[model samples]
Target: MADAQATGPILQLQGVQTHIGPYHILHGVSFEVPRGGVTMLLGRNGAGKTTTLRTIMGLWRASAGTVTFDGTDITRHSTPAIAQAGIAYVPENMSVFSDLTVAENMRLAARTGAIDERRLDWVFRMFPALKTFWHQRAGVLSGGQKQMLSVARAIIEPRQLLIVDEPTKGLAPAIIQNMIHVFRELKQTEVSILLVEQNFHMAKSVGDTVAVMDDGRTVHTGAMAALAEDDTLQQKLLGLSLAAHQ
Candidate 1:
């Protein structure tokens, strides 16, 4: 893993606390996604993993602490403001415009006047399947294709950070493998990813660092290699024993 302090983190969430109505979800969550690494947010269901991503995107406001992106405090920014600030979010639902074609979806994601040809080429390169389905309506696409499209659209703008929520959630084994390959290819780029994933194998395959959340708080933070070795830590935090994988 890279030294977070030396290269500087593209996104940093410090002591963030969030609540929905009277239900407190996140408590003092703090972590950093360095300039060019995938930081996996790992936890069981209802551990505030998705909420944390929402908070970063300003979909859910944090009652305390700050969300810093590219060294700027964007804790209180709006969703549009956060997006304009170079942070992209792909929610659990893979929010693609169902009525639109794949190309049209990409066009809508282009904030700038002219579309980014370089980013378009890169996205197509990463997922050639997308290029083949460019004219097809997003609603008819497969689960994996929609996920790819969602991620591709998010990266169309020059984003410094990407918050992906449960990307592998409901994907088939083969689709999950392909998605993992896509994430690996994305990691080779300059974008920093904050991946909220319950798929431990997928997370382990692509993540540079992993943070385990339990009961609305971060309970463990370490390199992927270290976490892969500690069966006790895996079971305690994620309720899954990685002993079989070992």
Candidate 2:
């Protein structure tokens, strides 16, 4: 992984607590996504990883504490305003417009209301299936293709930070490799990424830093390679051998 580029976190959550309706989900959740790298948020199912992503995006109001993006407090910002600040979120549900063509979906994600030719070309290069399916309705795409479209939509406009929830969900091994390649390339552009992923291999392969979450709180933080190399730590924190999880 490249040396850390920024002096501070591109995304920071401090003592953030969230309550969804009657359920108290996040209990003072806190972590940071370092600048210029992929920060993997790993945990077992129901660990509040998805809730954390939603809180960061203002999809869920934090009952306490803060979410700071690029040094600006965004805990109370509207979703659109938060997005305007250059944070793009790709949720597990993907949220692609089923009725819209792939091209239309990309257009909607662009701040200018139209895709930039150069940027579109760049993304198409990374995910050629997207360009091949450009005129097709998003509803018809396979699971992997839909995931690709979700990512493509998030980057239709240049963003300072990108937050994704379980991007490899339901993807085959080949698709996971492709996603890793796309992320590795994106890292070089210096657009920091915060990923919630359960696939241990995917996390280790693409992450520069990692945070382990359990029951809505971060339990460990360290370099990805360190986590990958420590089998005992993996068993202790993740409850399985990292190799076995893959």
Candidate 3:
């Protein structure tokens, strides 16, 4: 295997295709997630953004093409194997164990079978509410708090790549701002992130680069600043102006 650190992209997809049963979802999707920054996956509804994330995570295997992670081909790897390779995924649903306490839910996410105190402390610093409700059941938490717990679980240990889908979908404005802050801080740790978000403001604020998907294929890829600055390009790819979303 090549040295991952020497490679520029932590994750790369090339001509990736996925089919959910008989329905073809991802048709030759391709993109790259740079080594140490947030990469936003942006598109309109039914654009296969979530499908792309799932394919990368091995929840849905790629029927064709390749998903290379830090120089490894992971397209055919199992979900657990993909995770073991140091990629953590937080799906759009924020799938926390509703019956479990915050602590229990977190404990389950730790692959080492026990949560490291130092890393737990880091998670607490990013989300104080999780610390406050350590013993509370996950189901009883508010929407935004649940989202935080989901993210905290993914980062309870070190990971090379973090893939999150639609994190700001229904979050309140204040909570969205908090999430933006958390993402910014996480990037400082040199963890590469592939984030799928509909909130253009949050995407623009935290994203260093972006890949825009449309009709199950990647149509555009470039610097996030470039997309944000060009209203005409934003309209062409995303079908909406970033300024209007602000």
lDDT of 3 by residue, 70-104 (tens): 88889899999999999999999998999999999
Candidate 1 matches the true fold with a TM-score of 0.93
Model 2 sits at a Cα RMSD from the real structure of 2.9
Residue 108, model 3: lDDT of 94
Q: Which residue runs of candidate 3 sit more than 4 Å off their true CA positions?
A: 1-5
TM-score ranking from best to worst? 3, 2, 1
Rank list by lDDT: 3, 2, 1
Determine which window of 10 residues in candidate 3 has minimal summed lDDT.
1-10
- Residue pairs clashing in model 2 are none
**Best by TM-score, which number?**
3
Q: Give per-residue CA lDDT, model 1, range 1-246, as digits (tens).
A: 245444788888899999999999999999878788799998888888989989998999999999988877999999999988888899999999999999999998887546778777878887788899999999999988899899888887877788899898898888888888888988888788999987778887999998888888988887977897788878877788766642
* Candidate closer to the true structure by lDDT (higher is better), 1 or 3: 3
| Consecutive 10-residue window with the lowest summed lDDT within model 2 | 1-10
The root-mean-square deviation over C-alpha atoms between each candidate and the true structure, in angstroms, is 2.8, 2.9, 1.1
Cα lDDT over the full model 2: 0.91
**lDDT for position 99 in model 1:** 94
Candidate-wise lDDT, in order: 0.86, 0.91, 0.94
**Tens digit of lDDT per residue, candidate 2, span 1-246?**
123324678999999999999999999888888889899999878888999999999999999999988878999999999999989999999879999999899888887797789999999999999989999999999999999999999987889999999999989999999999999999999699999998888998899999888898889988999999999999888888888867
